[model samples]
Target: MENKNKYIILTTMLIQSTLLIVINCTIIDTSTLEALKSSMPIFNIMILITTVLMLLSLKKANSFIKKETELELVKSNMKNTEDLLNLLRTQRHDYLSHIQAIESLIILKEQEELEEYIKGISKEYRITNEMIRLGNSVLTAIINTKKEIAEKKGIVFHVRCKNKVSLHGINSWELSSIISNLIENAIEEASSIENEKWIKITISYVYNNFVFEIENTRKINNEIGDNIFKPGVSSKNAAGRGYGLFIVKNVVEKYNGSIEFKTTEKNSIIFKVILPSEDGAYGEKAI
Candidate 1:
């Protein structure tokens, strides 16, 4: 669009310049024609060259926009597939655990213990269901799904949300992308620590702000490079693995929200996000 506008401006300027030159040639005496002749062809040639340049620029701009949009769609699909795979993996692991528990109970002949074990699992699932049952269905699904993954990884995950969050302008998929990337990074970083690794996530409305925080354990002296969030800046040596935090930053900034990271020498790393709570603003709604 910008390139097209520039082309239009250049075309107008060319017309105006040509008209001015013609008027001067007609109004002035014959002597001025020789003076104008030297510069007029050069000016016309420049106008033609600029027109061609504008066309090329517009074509390149259009191609770039199309490619970017396609890449975004691909990323969105990949995130969905990853989320589904995580869910499936959690269920598979749980099924194996259930079978093992039943087998152990059968060998020990502990009917009461087996029943109690099943009941305990059921209760925990119920609690998980309730924590993410927000007013918005999409957020509810995202939180609950991520909660299951966190539990499967033995990562202590916590949530505190209210029903007043407005999700008007934010797309469900983008929100999923943002939260999923944040939580996944937290889990991965926490898992690297030797201590009791945990991730605490809180979403709440305070005054006019909607606040979200995810904190997890990490090594004290781990120096995250200044360019850690840049695209392609990955701890992984392999390709295509380092874009998570870069996308997270982009999504957060898209909604006029801000995210900060803090680390203590011997403590934990915390990521805090604060966004406006106005209608149509991006935030997680309480179930």
Candidate 2:
């Protein structure tokens, strides 16, 4: 659409300039010098008006593009929040079932099974608590949602976070895009395989930087070589399949962050993103 608009503008200018040149040449030959001079101001005014209108159009185009980008970010944040709320509701139902089961076990006087059941519940709650303690609702929601998706697809998803990691300078929307895109890609790749399907994600704070590392079982697709982060490049042959990593790379670089991926000898791929905890020298400090 943008290129089409540019071509239309160029063609319109070409036709206008040609007509103006033809009109001036005819006036120069058939009219008095004073008459031609009087017509020049009219031509000048026409050019001025066209230039001003074109400038205004260009300004509006830029503003529209900016708003479109902001709208996408807002939509992403809202989806993440909705997923988090849904997961919370599911957990609430699960807690009720757990309580009922425990009461039943107690009534049945199954001491050994009750002990084992309580232990299992404790371990599960610990993992959930750790994820909640990450202190960023966006991150927690995206990871949890992706994990659920991976599990439903028969892909094991594991997340490890030992500390309270925080993203001080990054907004929820940007953070959501980065983490969600990477993990979603991992899940998709892992799910494609028939065997040994699994995804592992590790979040940590190291050396004043927040680190996100996702690894998944994937066969090497040589088509993606070094240009995996480039736009319109994808292992999948579907339309609109490759822009996720490209956007992720752009957001990471916008914050002076770095992203790298490597394939393991075990037929697994890992993507690692490192972003500064504080704002980078050239990064936006809003969030």
Candidate 3:
């Protein structure tokens, strides 16, 4: 919408300026008006070229604004993540004590209680260490933070990346925005349903493109299915619930990437983004 508004304003100003120029020309003395006629074609051509260049400049400005906004968001997320980790570390200071207690319980022949306690700790560890060591720190940070958000909302978040998935030429922040937005939307949609809610993310390399598949157990309304990526389209029935996918679509397209999804009436939605791995494969190298 920000870019759209700029385009509209630029276009309006262009039309107004063109009209004013023509009016000024009409009011000139007849001899001068006649002299200007021969140059009218050239003047109009120049105006057209200027208009095109101005629009291009505006579009480039919009892209830079978006990049800066996403960068700030990433920095904010990283800071909050640092705070969250510190808090977790503080809480986990008792981790060793908890293990000692379990050992003491075992020494006291309390098999049943020790078993339950160990199982609980194991589950917690699973949630905290959900993703494999995929050698991509940016993606790891995104999944960790998003997983915490999902768990707090009673949503099950799972990641499957057994093999290495490197974003060959994409900026870490760019990939971070893409992954964060997709999973964030999935969490929102899946949490709305009354039935079982879960989100699964799988990352793999299909040769030239790195693919991200986020599957969730929520049925999207057909009304929204057609325009899901269009800005302001949301099934959540609330304002500010629709920008994630729109941003995802824009970034994916900027890289000459493709974003596709499959939704079913059976309460399942899968979004797949395939981005080229080679630098300059699709877009002007992101600044």
Candidate 4:
């Protein structure tokens, strides 16, 4: 569409220029015609230069758009793969526990104990099934997977999510990326503390925005400064690292949303995100 508009505008301009040139040529004297003919080469050169520049600009713009689209698709696929891997890991870990329980029960050679072990497994399955009744499968899967990891690390993970959320405006891949990275970072930082570590996440729908807040226990040093979101600015000492916050900022800003960070002297950090409702237009109120 943009290319077509540009072409139409250029064609219109060329036709108007030709007509004006003809009209002026017919009304002008022979001296003027000679001068116009002599200046024809310059005019042609200018037109050629303009056309080249326009085409070059269009090509560059098109390339950039294509590259951006490709990057987005790759990011989406990566998120899907990550989610699948997390699920698989959880299942594998659970399977190990089941194997251990079965091995112990078989060695006891007691029929009653064997039946009880099977019942225990059934009860565990029922509990998992009940917990996943939250309606949003993605959210349930992610929360359950993370919960397991946090428990394994002896960190307290708390969640306060509303019944259902409008996922319309946001791409699932980008949303998952943002949430996963933030939670993972919180967990990692919290685990390093000597005292009890905790991460709290709250997701709620307010007026015309979907608000997400994550708080974690971590000491923020002066090294973070104002460049915490800058790519490759991580305190983790490895070169070519620190792109998590950069990714989060890019995804949030794409939807005209806002994110902020607050840190207390006591080493508690809170990250808040306010995104426009998917069904609402920019600067418009939600119904």
Q: Which stretches of candidate 1 lie over 4 Å from their true place?
A: 1-131, 220-222, 235-239, 280-285
The number of the candidate with the highest lDDT is 2
lDDT score for residue 4 of model 4: 56
**How does residue 130 of candidate 4 score in lDDT?**
39
Position 208, candidate 4: lDDT: 77
- Model 3, span 139-226: residue lDDT tens: 7667777777888889988788744555667766678778878888888888888879899998766667778899999877888899
Worst lDDT run of 10 residues, candidate 3, spans 278-287
- Candidate 4 lDDT over 171-273, as tens digits, reads 7667776777778788888888989699888877777787889898986666785788999988678888788888888889988988888897767898898
Per-candidate clashes come to 3, 0, 0, 0
Worst 10 residues of 1 by lDDT: 278-287
Mark the 10 consecutive residues where model 4 has the least summed lDDT: 278-287
Off by over 4 Å in 4: 1-141, 280-287
Alpha carbon deviation, residue 224, candidate 2 (Å)? 1.7
| Top TM-score model | 2
Please list all clashing residue pairs in model 4, or write none if there are none.
Answer: none
Predicted structure 3: lDDT: 0.76
Write down the TM-score of every candidate: 0.61, 0.73, 0.68, 0.63
Q: Write the per-residue lDDT of candidate 1 for residues 150-241, one digit (tens) a residue.
A: 76787777777764456666666666666777787887877776668788877777666767787887743344456667898765567787
lDDT of each: 0.69, 0.79, 0.76, 0.71
